[model samples]
Target: MLRLILIGLLLLVIFPVLASAAKVMSADNSHWSTARRDSTGIAPDPKTTPEAVVQVYAARAFNWRGIFGVHSWIAVKPEKAESFTRYEVEGWGVSSGRESVRIGSYRPPDAYWFGNYPELLVDIRGAEAAALIPQIAAAANSYPYRDRYTIWPGPNSNSFVAHVARNVPGLRLDLPPTAIGKDYRTDGIFGVAPSNTGLQLSLFGLAGVTLALEEGVEVNLLGLTVGIDILTPAIKLPGIGRIGFPQGPS
Candidate 1:
């Protein structure tokens, strides 16, 4: 009986230490994976796979009165790193498709229009793509929706700020929780004729609690400005999309 008790006590002490050691080892492994292998923790090289290049675009118009207005786009690439490794393409076009998506009681069919007319072109390397996708998705779902809402807001702004900081944990900064009472809406659209052509990224669905980090890169383009943000880490979006750290790199 005494021997049994001794062994029990030993396990009680050793088990926690063993568990802690395992956690530490895991953390170290995760760190190495991200730093050395890949920039966004998704795929080391997105351009390496031709399929990695994804194009997202949409367009919509509404009519309120006699006036007919149109908004469209060319393309904008979503990125999580400084450069794209896997994909490069120079394409230009605009999208215009009218639909009745009511914003208020008065549903305009053609007069009211919102879309992007992008002509500038960008190259998305593999590392950059891994980091860019999630931020764009998050921005698409973010709060304080303007005429339309976006996650990264395309490759335009120098910085991407989340109104609800909880949505992106990889940013590695503190963000206050969003207020409870506010009305928010979002729409993603693209025009038919583009002034410039660059890589364009759009979200198809609300993302899960995926692991990611926000990275900003300075950019200059002829007759246009190119700003890029990369999202990092391979993460699974659990029930609540708000950001939090789990064990391991992602």
Candidate 2:
């Protein structure tokens, strides 16, 4: 068993390092201030659609951070609303007393994260979206980490999204393995998975195991996660995320 665990740990470190090296070679070296933040046309226009919509998005984090993980956020558009509201936790300005939880319609709902294109993780529309919008808003507002931000382990952007996902199970959000802070548990070491479909035991997000219908089996080590998705047939890696099949709401 010890040999097996050692082998697993070696694989976890080696694979993510290889993936990160590849990402570095092909990375966009643009400065964050000048990086593209335009919309990718993935979101339905609020004026034209007029239907309630809820979406979860993840994008490679800016600069070198992109090589390791992604930043996740949630956006919502209510029926007949002319704009979408986005909820995300950002580390910027936290030391200056600004809250980490940012809620507004400042940018395009589907805008790129710096230079990284955003991938839609979950999409819900019509009546279902309308019903869940309030709950999502409440979850965002009630997030305990609004005043705190930690890039590794717990209570960062991914943690914020995970909290919202756990509260709104209808989302069935399957955050990718690259969402590094997703396993951070605010309530305790034991809690429901972000998908709310199974259980997870995490030690303040540093290390843990997650098993769920949506997330499959993920082992978190030192804030990095490696796993296999049985339901979707994918191998979840640290830096490169899932390989084999795409995951999203049906």
Candidate 3:
């Protein structure tokens, strides 16, 4: 039984990562500065729409990291706003005394992360978006790891997005399994799932189990996740992400 379990894990988890790593290695963008960061044009045009909007996006992380996980961010545009504000965390400038939490409109709301295209995880508009914007901002501002970042068992980018999702349950954000740090618990080992529909118990984000209405059942081993999303009827793999029905805004 144990051997079968190990084989299943190897097929479901390790193989996907190895396959993704092959593609990452062959990519032309050899350096971060040269990677594509253009907008994917999926976001609503704030200048023309004029409605409050909130969106969450995730993309494969830069370079080799893309093989294991992704970086995610939240973007908001209040009613009548001309631009969007994006909030995310990164480890890049932290060592040089820069805060890990970044808030600004320096880039388009749906800009690619390095050379990787982004996937929208949540979309809320108009009054609903307006109501949730402030709460999301507050959650981002209060992120406990604003000055720290750990790529593995982390308070990294995924952790930031998960934090916001937990605080603003209305978003119904369903972070993918490749979002390695989404289960990190800054306050304690036990807490509500990021989707806020169920409960989770994570040991510093490394090992955990999440059972939620939106998430279904997930198991995290060393920051890699494997599970089944009963809500969407999908299988979540560690490095390859979701497979089955398409998940998007309802």
Candidate 4:
């Protein structure tokens, strides 16, 4: 039984990435720019849009890294607000003594990430968004590893969002299975799940098991997650995200 489980875990880590390698970009898009790419115009225009909006989005990571994981960020617009605030942790500046974590509002929250269309992970509008904004901001600002970053098993981009999710249960978010390194918890080896609704045991992010309402049952091995979304009726894989037709009926 133990060997079977090991084989299953190995397959989960390898098969999806290999199968999806054809779609993963081997190089960064020439159009890689932080500027807005709002061809769909789905992002709310603060001036015309309603009050209190919050959204979480994730896009494939740059270049060959896209084969393995995604980068995620949060955006919030408070009640009667005129604009949205976007927050994310960038790895480029960490080597130069600059903080990797940043917050701004110049670009649309839903903009394509370097030619990759982002997936909307969570959206809360109106009063609920307003109520959550302050807590989210606080959690982002107070993140302990603001200046640090690691591509795997670390305080990378996914870790930031996971931290905020753990702190704010109202979000009820489960980072996508393809979101590698989302289980890197610094507080301790054993603690509550980020969704605040379950228990998790981790070995410094290299391996872990999480049982939660939002996250279901997940096993993380070397930062690759394999899980089942019992509530949503889908099997979550490492690189391909959720399978079993998670997108709804055809």
Q: Over all chains combined, what TM-score does candidate 1 have? A: 0.20
Using TM-score as the measure, name the better of candidate 2 and candidate 4.
2
Put down candidate 2 lDDT per residue, 214-245, tens digits, no spaces: 88999998888889999999998888788888
Q: What is the lDDT of candidate 2?
A: 0.90
Against the hidden reference, what TM-scores do the models get?
Answer: 0.20, 0.96, 0.97, 0.90
Q: What lDDT is reached at residue 196 by model 4?
A: 86
Local distance difference test, each candidate: 0.24, 0.90, 0.90, 0.81
Ranking by TM-score: 3, 2, 4, 1
In model 3, the runs with Cα more than 4 Å from the true position are none
Best of the two (3, 4) by lDDT = 3
Task: List candidate 2 stretches off by more than 4 Å.
Answer: 1-7
Cα shift from native, residue 214, model 3 (Å): 0.6
Question: Lowest lDDT 10-mer window, candidate 3?
Answer: 23-32
Cα miss at 109, model 1 (Å)?
23
**Would you list the clashing residue pairs of candidate 4?**
none
Worst 10 residues of 4 by lDDT: 27-36
Candidate 4 residue-pair clash tally: 0
